[model samples]
Every structure is written in C-alpha cells, then in structure tokens.
Target: MEESAILNNSECTRKCSENLSAVEDAIYVIGGKWKLKIIIVLQESGNIRFNELQRNIQGISARVLSNELKDLELNGFVKRVVHAEQTPVIVEYISTDYSRTLKPVIMALSEWGKTHKRNIREDAF
Candidate 1:
C-alpha cells in the first residue's frame, strides 16, 4: 500500500497503489521460472503428460516439476486430467482458458527479449 516499499527512491510516484497492485498480481501468477516455462510449453503443446513435460524442460528435476504443476493447478492456470483404467493412472496437464489469456503477454515479452538481445549484441560488436 505504501509507495516507498512498492518502488525505490528517486522514482516519480504516479498511481503507486494501482501499479503496485498490478505488480503483485503478476507475481502471484508467474512468480517462479518453472511456472513461466511450463505455461509456455503447455501453450505451445496444447496438452502433455508429466514425463513429456519433464523431458521437454531439460534440466528441471522431477520434484520441482511436480511441485510446479501442483501450484499451477492450484492457481487455475492448468487443468489436470486423470485417466483411470488399469493399475497406473495417466495424468495429463493442459493449459486452461485463464492461462490462454497470458499467451499474448508472454509472446510479447519473448519478442522483446529477442529484440533486446539483438540490439545489445550489435552494440557490443
């Protein structure tokens, strides 16, 4: 609620409460690296299983992926489908409509990062 804690010194305060609330909401949704990556992967792939996701993420540990999936589900960004049949159950993770809303924001950020990297590299060289 305080502008001092929300932003650093020397920064012009304009609608500090609104800006801080937006930042807080963004953090609440995409707080971790894994959550962002998971959302991207699910957005691109549509639907995937635990093992498939883990493989695609490269270095993400099993425990971390599991925890992230649970957190995503809890936050309503992802939907878990459990197929009951034989001994082992098949659980699939799919991006929910709420997560689809973030596609444009994520894609814009991705493009911005690419352009920023290109600019920096050209400046360096």
Candidate 2:
C-alpha cells in the first residue's frame, strides 16, 4: 500500500470513530424505550398534564414515566410547568424548542422503521 493510501485510511478510520462517539452521546440522552415516545407525544400535544402524558404512552408505569420526564428535563428536551395557583395545582410537560432539532432524526427513524417492517413481512412469506 502507498503511504498516501495509509494516511487516507487512518483519517477515514478517525472520522468513523468520531461519528460513532456522536451517536453514543445522542443515545445517552434520548435513546431509550420511553424517552423518544415521551418526546413524540409532548411535541404533538403541546402542554400536557402528567397523568395525561402517562396515559398517552400506554403501558409505562408512573414511576418510569416520572423518571424519564426528569431525564428529558435534565437534557433540555422537555420542560415541566406547574400551575401552582390553580385549585388542584396542574403540572404539565412541554417539549423544548431544542427538542425540535430531533425532528429530522425522528423522521429518518420513522422511514427506516417502515422499511424494516415491510422487509420483515416480505421475508416471512
């Protein structure tokens, strides 16, 4: 192999490694069974109460939902609002503008998921 070829390969490997690191960081923040689902619901529903959000995400326990909400809030993906003055103290979760940055990622995943489902069904025949 030429020296230039070796150098090019090293650079390509470094770039690939860096890209994997970026993916890992994103997963750390938003990659879970419940986090993305919660984000999707909040983005679609505007400000939603805790119980309502829990119901929207069928099968998630309240404890798990609360923990996911805290993680999302900590990562700047969701915000918790409290209407303390109201008689019952309404609390709501809202998606942050920052979370909208995931729109393209979510769309890509949706497309890929559809494609994967189609391929699986075809193979099952």
Candidate 3:
C-alpha cells in the first residue's frame, strides 16, 4: 500500500506539472504589457474603430496598437471587421466569444490590483 501511495503521489505531481506548463503557455500568449489592457478596452467599448482604440488607450502608439490587434486576432481573442460598403472603408475591432471567457479573469485581476494598491498606500504611510 505504501508503494502504491508513492506512485500515486508521483502521478499527481506529473499531472500538475503538465497543467502548469499549459497555464504558462496561455499566459505567454495573453500576458503582455498591452494585451490585457487592449482586451479590457474592447470588453467595455464593444466594436471600436482603429483610431478610437488608439485614442482611448492613451500612450499606446498606432504601430503598437496595430501589432497588438493583429496578435489578438491571430490568437482568436479579437475579430476584425472591414466595412467596405461605405465610401470610405472602415475597420473595426471587437472581442470574440473566446475573449469573453476572460471576463472573470480580468475582474479578478482588477479586484486584486485595487487591494494591492491599497496595501502599497498603507505601507507607504
């Protein structure tokens, strides 16, 4: 029984390690300085034009925003729509269903950040 328990423990550890690796990979795709920020903006604003997004994000360059949008679209987190019917074509960005799945994650992070900020302020005083 002892030997079997040891084997079970090792198997559990191996499964946890595999899960950890997958979580790391997911973070690698979405864990960036701007990715989550952009996602949050889209979540709040819904479909938004390129220029509008650039203006809203503050401090994000047009080039960087463009690159980040491309990455998000590639990762299935964002959808790009081109309105060619208009005299002047308009391109819009919207968060995809997959991206909506991150709402809880974003809210949790926001809550944690608020608490962290309060903690830092308290410590400083």
Candidate 4:
C-alpha cells in the first residue's frame, strides 16, 4: 500500500482535516508572542493604560504593543476608551466580554504547561 492511501484510510480522515481547519483559524486569530499575554493581563487587570500594559508585559516595545492593541481591538477582543473627563485625560484598553470566552482555553493551557514543565524536570533528573 502507498503512504498516501494508508494515511487516507487510517486516522487522518475528513473529520480530522476539518478539525485542522478550526485549529488553523484559531492560530490565525490568536497565534503570536504577545497577543495571549496581553489578553491575560487585561483579563486580570480589567482596564489598563498603554504604559501600564507595557510595564506589565515587560520587554515589549511601544510600537509593537500599539500594533497588537490595534489588532486586538480590530478583532473585538479588547476595547480602547478615551476618558476626557479627567484633567490629564485617560486612554485605556479593556478586555471585552468576548475576550472572556477564552478563559477556559487559558486555564487549560496553564494546566498543561505546568504539567509539561514538571515532566521535563522529572526527566532531567
């Protein structure tokens, strides 16, 4: 039997291919070095100024953070609010309710990461 035929006949079926599509779509939206970190910070802090968010993340440049915020806002994951009432005025980025939907995903990733780190340490010894 050929390799392609074996794969087609085995576990890699149409359903699995469809699942790959969903994973790809997810990666397209949220796959990056800074996005999930930014979301996590906003999720924890509620609303934050640009400087605060930058300080929280650490090592991320202002230009990159600004670009990421624009992308997050465009995707409906966060909101940018300008408060004109205060003397100095305030600009804040807030996590949207839509962003809250990622809570389960974040929790799962955290759990898996912790477990993986433990496993790696165990193997090293």
The most accurate candidate by lDDT is: 2
**Could you tell me the TM-score of candidate 2?**
0.96
- lDDT string for model 1 (3-118, tens) is 77657543536667779989999998788778999999998898799999999997999999999999999989999998888459888899999999998989899999999999
The residue-by-residue lDDT of candidate 3 on 79-112, one tens digit each, is 9999999979999999999999999988999999
lDDT of 1 at 112: 96
Cα RMSD, model 2: 1.5
Per-residue CA lDDT of model 4 for 1-125, tens digit only, reads 59879887776677788899999988888889999999999999998999999999989999999999999999999999999999799999999999999999999999999999999989955
Candidate 3, run of 10 with poorest lDDT: 116-125
State the displacement of the C-alpha of residue 52, model 2, in Å, after optimal TM-score superposition: 0.5
Better of 1 and 4 by TM-score: 4
Query: For each candidate, what TM-score against the reference?
Result: 0.82, 0.96, 0.89, 0.87
C-alpha lDDT (0 to 100) for residue 10 of candidate 1:
35
Candidate 3 wrongly placed segments (more than 4 Å): 1-5
RMSD of 4: 3.4
Model 4 — which ten-residue stretch has the worst lDDT? 6-15
- Give candidate 1's TM-score: 0.82
